[model samples]
Target: MSKLKFFVFVLFMIISVSEIRSQIVINEIMYAPLDANNEWFEIYNNGITPVNLQNWKWKDATSTIRTITTQSIILSANSYLIICQDSNKLKIQFPGINGIISTNFMECPE
Candidate 1:
């Protein structure tokens, strides 16, 4: 009986962890821009706890997987993170926008 209880607990934990990981989702994407370099996407953390995004990756339908960041990035709970092709250009295009900005994002698919 104890072993069965332990197995159930482990399954619950695994499901919880998967749910938490799924909370970080792609919220928005700017595929086409007046300046191609201004392309970007928004990722939102809807979970209650912050998520560590170190060594995360992304890719479009036509491209291979690309690394998003190698450095540690803690996305706060209920907040957004912006990944951009060119941080400087995106800033100039949308002045005073909020959220954490990360560079080196590749072009998004249409």
Candidate 2:
């Protein structure tokens, strides 16, 4: 209500927001069905902030795993992040029961 109180409140909000940390959460995981040339994994950032995926990775039932340190990616505030076997050729499959969820925009080759 008072000037001092408002300033304190604003400062607290800024600090609290900035202090928050983002966790790399795997919201969904699936294998591409189109020809199965490569597998893909989807990650979601369910935090109130953003995160850099420079040194990220993923694993499955097998011993073979994946690391995304070379990939330059940053998940938005509230969006799904895609990781494909072939970043240049393969398409990012959305979290779907099958292959009926992705927009197929990047699926088609130019």
Candidate 3:
């Protein structure tokens, strides 16, 4: 095979492996402030089935874990859910957003 063809094959293999490994993937994260107090992370349901986030948790690089305990959240297949610091603030910033789905996370210990 040509060098270009070989490169494409390797890239395709890597991406296929990644997709297989990721059941529920973190699609986007807003670390820095979009405004003064807007911080959020988006999770994507990459699997074919819906996922229940009833007791799911998120942990940062520092191992700070926060569980979702407020309400039961179910994310459908090929859908996205944005977990935010303040859903109200997020809605205010993006007025066109029809609905906001979120839960409060406990403050991580320093």
Number of the predicted model whose lDDT against the real structure is largest: 1
* Tens digit per residue, CA lDDT, model 2, 1-110: 69999999999998875654435566665565565545556667777667776545444445445465444556667667666555434434323432121212132111
**What's the distance in Å from true for residue 95, model 3?**
2.0
TM-score of each: 0.79, 0.50, 0.66
lDDT of residue 26 for candidate 1: 96
Candidates in order have lDDT scores of 0.81, 0.54, 0.73
Q: Itemize residue pairs with steric clashes in candidate 3.
A: none
lDDT tens string, model 1, 6-108? 9999999999989988989999998877877777889999998999888677875467676777778899999999988677777777888877465666443
- lDDT of candidate 3 vs native? 0.73
Winning model by TM-score: 1
In the range 48-109, model 3's lDDT, one tens digit per residue, is 87777776766865688877544677788888888876888888877876425656676444
TM-score of 3: 0.66
